[model samples]
Target: MDKYKQYFLKNIRKKLEEWETVPSISHNEVYRFLHSIAGTASIIGFDEIGSKARKLMNQLNETDDKQWTIEEVKQYLFEIIEWFDENKKDAPVSFTDKGNKYGDKPVILLIDDDTSFLMYMKEQLEKVGWYVAAIANPQKAITSFYDVRPDCVVIDIHMKETDGFAVLEFLKEKLKQQFIPTIMVSVDSSKAVRIKSYEMGADDFIQKPFDLDEFIVRVKRQLERKKHIDEMLLLDELTHVYNRKYLKQAYALLQSDWQRSQEPFCLAVLDLDHFKQVNDRYGHLVGDVVLREFARFLKQGTRVSDIIVRFGGEEFVILFPKTRREEASEVVNRLREQFECHSFREGGTAFSRTFSCGVVEITDANEPLEHWLRLADNALYEAKENGRNRVVSATPSQEAVHQKIIKIAVVDDDPIMRTIITDIVTKLPCERKTKHELQTFKDGVEFIASNWHREHSPCLVILDGVMPKMDGLEVLQWIRQQKRSDRYKVIMLTSRRSENDIARALELGADDYITKPFKLLELEARICQMMKRMS
Candidate 1:
C-alpha cells in the first residue's frame, strides 16, 4: 500500500479507539476526522472505504445534538473499518505518476494553519525544484494569491481563522479568469468534507502525515496537468503557434505600447494558396504536415519580437512590431519567395506550395484594432484578386480611399425628402479625391428595381420606412436576402416614432433607425460612425 493508504488506516484506528473511550470527543471532532478519511480514500480510489466513512460522517453531521454517544460513534467507526478491511486487499497501491512530463518549474502556494507542517512541506517541495510559498493564515493566502501567481495551491481544510473550503471559494472569485489547481489536506478523514471540497472545485485531497515522495509526486502531477490544459487553451495544436486567445492578449500589450510610445507596427495576413487542393490531392494527414511545416517556416523567418499566430485553418497572422510599411513588405516578400521555392512532401511524393500575404501599417492612433485588421484583410482580398503567391502592402491613405469611397442611395416617395437626404450626404466632409456619389430614387419600389448594388454598390442606403409599394422594411428585407447583406449599411428614415416600427426595422436588419426630423449633426455623426466601421 502507498503511504497515504497506510497512514489513513493507522490514524482512523487510533481516532476510533479514542472516540469509543472519550465521551468528551464532540460529534464535530469525530465527523471532521471521518470526513478527511473519506476524502483521502476517494482520492486514492478506495471507493468502498470512502463511501462507508462518508455515510457515517453525514449521519453524525445530521444529528440533532453536537455531541455523539460513545456507542453511536463506535458503530460508525466499526462500519468504516469493516469496509476498509474488506477493500484493503484489492486497493491500488498508488496514484498514477504524471510528473517530469513538462519542463516548467511549478510555483506552489501552500496554506496551512499548522506553521511547522507548512514550513516543512515548503522546504521539501523547494528541495525538489518547486517554488513554494508557505502561508499559515487562510485569509493571507487568499489575499496574496494574485501576487504569488502560483501554478497550484495546497491548503489545509482545518485552518484556524477559516477552513480550506472557504479559501477555495475566495480564491475562485479572485481567479475567475483562469484555472488553478487546488488541493485540500486535513487529518479528519470524513466523506462529507471530501464531497464539499470537490463540489467547491478542489483538484485533489490528501490526509495528514502524507508520504513526502508521494506528496511531491501528486503536486508535480497537478502542475503537469495544468500545463497541458493551459497549452491547449493558448496554443494552436497543429502548428503550435500562439492561438487567437494569446493573440488578443499580445495585441492588448502592443496596443498599450502604441498609445504610450507611438510605436510603429504592422499586421500581416497570410493564406496558403491552393491549400484546399493540398488536402484533396494528398490527403488531410499530409495537409496537416504541410501546415505544421509552414508554421515552422514562419517562426524561423520572423524576428524574435514578431508575434506569429495561427489565425485559423491555413491562415496565419503576424504582428511586426517596430517595423515600417516598406520594411514589413520586404520581410514578408522574402518569406514568400522562400515558401514558393520550398517543396513539401507526403510519403516521399513531393509537391510545391506557395502563399499570398497582405500587410497594413498601423498609422491612426484613434483607429480601433478591428479597423487595422480589416485594412489588412482588404489588402489580402486585393492580393487574391490580382493573383496569389505575392505580397501586397496598404498604406493608411490607400486604405481610407478604398474603404471611404461611399456610394449612397436615397429612396423616398417624396422628391423633396429624397433631395434633402442626398444633399445632406453630398455636404459631408470627404477627401477631394474620393468618389462619393448620391443615387436618388422616387420610391422603394424604384430603388429595388434598379441595379444599383450590381455596379458600385452603395455603402449606405437612406430608405424611408413608409413608402408607397415595397416599403422601406420590404426593401431592407430584400437587400438582406441578397448575398453579403452585411456589406451594405442601411439607415431607415421613419416619420412615425412608434416603438413597434423602430423595433421592426431593427429586427429586419436596418443598421440604424432614424425618426423623422432628426438632428442634422446626429445623423452626420451616425454616418461618420458607419464610415469608421467601414474603414
Candidate 2:
C-alpha cells in the first residue's frame, strides 16, 4: 500500500483506538476520520474502504440511543477496516487488468492536503494506469493545473490555507474556463456547504466518508455531460443544418482564399412559397417537419463543400465556395426537384412543399458584399414572380437593355402584391421577346432615383398606394411635374377602393387602377390593353 493509504488506515485505527478508551466518541471526529479513509479508497478505486465506511457510519446512527462499550465500537470499526483492506488489494488488481485492456487513459489532477490520503489515492490510481498529479496545497494547484490540463480534477474540501470552494473559484476565474468538472470531497455534510460548492461551479461533491462507487459514477457523469454540450453547440436546433453562426465563421476563413485565387463562388437564397399558408392551414408542426425535411434534401443534394444555413423562418441560404453560377443552378435545381417530390407527414396527414430560389455569383470588386447578397434576394423575388417553385438568375447584360426594352417598373412594399404583379408581367407574351422587360422596386424613391432619367425611363410604372420614404401620390405628382407623364403609361395598384383615390390617380396621369386580389387573367388583360394603347 502507498504511504497515503497506509496513513489513512492508521488514522482509522487511531480513531477506533480513541473510541475504545473514550466514554463517548465525538461523532464529528469519527465522521472526519472515516470520511478521509473513504475518500482515499475511492480515489485509488478501492471500493470496499468507502463502502464499509458508509456502513459503519449508518450503524453508528442506528445505535445512537444505545450506550456502546469501547470494545464493541472497536470491534465494529475493525471489521469495517479489515474488510476494506482485503477488498482494496483485490479490487486494485482487477482494476489494473481492466485498465491495461483500455490502455493508459488521460491524467487526472487530485488536489487535497492530507498526505496519507493523497499517497493512497495516487498508488491506487497509478495501478490502474491513470497518471495523477496529487497536490497537498490548494495554492500550488493553479500552477500545476495549467501545466497539465487533466481530463478531470478531484479536489478535497479541507486544505491548509484554502478550502475546496476557494480552490474551485480560483480555477474558474484564473483558468478563464468553465465546464471543467471539479469534484469537491469534504467531511462537512452541511446542506449549505454543498449548495455553495455547486454555486462555485463544482460538478460533484463527496461528503467526508464517501462511498467509492458513488464517487466514480459522479465523475463519469460530469465528463459525459461536457462531451454532449460540445456536440450541441455545432448543430442548428431548428432545421439541424450547420447554423448561421457556424457558416459565418467558416465563410470568413474560406473567403480569403477564394478572393485571392479569383475563384468563382455562388450564393443562393431560398424561400418556401406561401409558407405562412402552410402554418395557417396545416398548422406550424407540419410546417416545421416540412422545413426539416427540405433542409435535409438541401444537404443531401449539395456538395460537401457547400454550406447551408437556416436564415430564420421559411428561408435558407447556401454558400457554394469555388463554384460558378451555372454549377450553382444545377445544385439548386436538384434541391428544388427533391423538395417537390418529397412528402412531409405529420399527425397522419401528408403534404408536399415547394420553394423558390435565387442564385447569384460572386463577381465585381467594386460592389460591396451586400450587393451579391441583394442580387440573390432580387433573383429570389424574380423566382417568386415568375411563379413559385422556380429558380432565377441575374444576367449582367439585362441592365444594358434598360432603354431599348419597354421598361416596366413594379414598386410595392407588400411582398405578395409585388410577387403577383411580377408573375403577371413575366407570363405576358411581350416578356418572352425581352422587349417588355420588368424591374421591381420596394418603394417609390428607389424607382424614381434609378429610372427617373429620360434616357432610361420606364414605359409603364405600377406604384403601390401606401409606402414609406414617399407615397405613390407624391411620386405621381413628381412624374406629372416633369412634363414626361404623357410619355409613360402609369398604373396605380391599390388595396383602397376609395373613389377619390382613383380619381386622384387618374388626375395625376395614371392610366388605370387595379384593386387588391384581382384575378391574374384580368390583370394580364389590363397590361395587354395598356401596352396596345402605348403602341
Among the numbered candidates, top lDDT falls to 1
The lDDT, on a scale of 0 to 1, for candidate 2 is 0.65
Lowest summed lDDT across 10 adjacent residues in model 1 is found at 95-104
Question: CA lDDT of each candidate?
Answer: 0.70, 0.65
Per-residue lDDT tens digits for candidate 1, residues 313-375, read 688999998788999999999999998989877777888898888899886545776677777
Residue-level lDDT for 133 in candidate 2? 57
Q: Per-residue CA lDDT of candidate 2, range 243-322, in tens?
A: 66575665665567676887878888899998866866775456666777888888888888788988766788898888
Task: Return the top candidate by TM-score.
Answer: 1
Model 2 TM-score, all chains together = 0.33
Question: After superposition, which runs of candidate 2 have C-alpha atoms over 4 Å from their true positions?
Answer: 1-234, 365-367, 396-535
What's the TM-score of every candidate structure?
A: 0.36, 0.33
Q: Please provide the root mean square deviation of candidate 2 (C-alpha atoms, Å).
A: 34.9
Model 2 residue 111 distance off true place after TM-score fit, in angstroms? 47
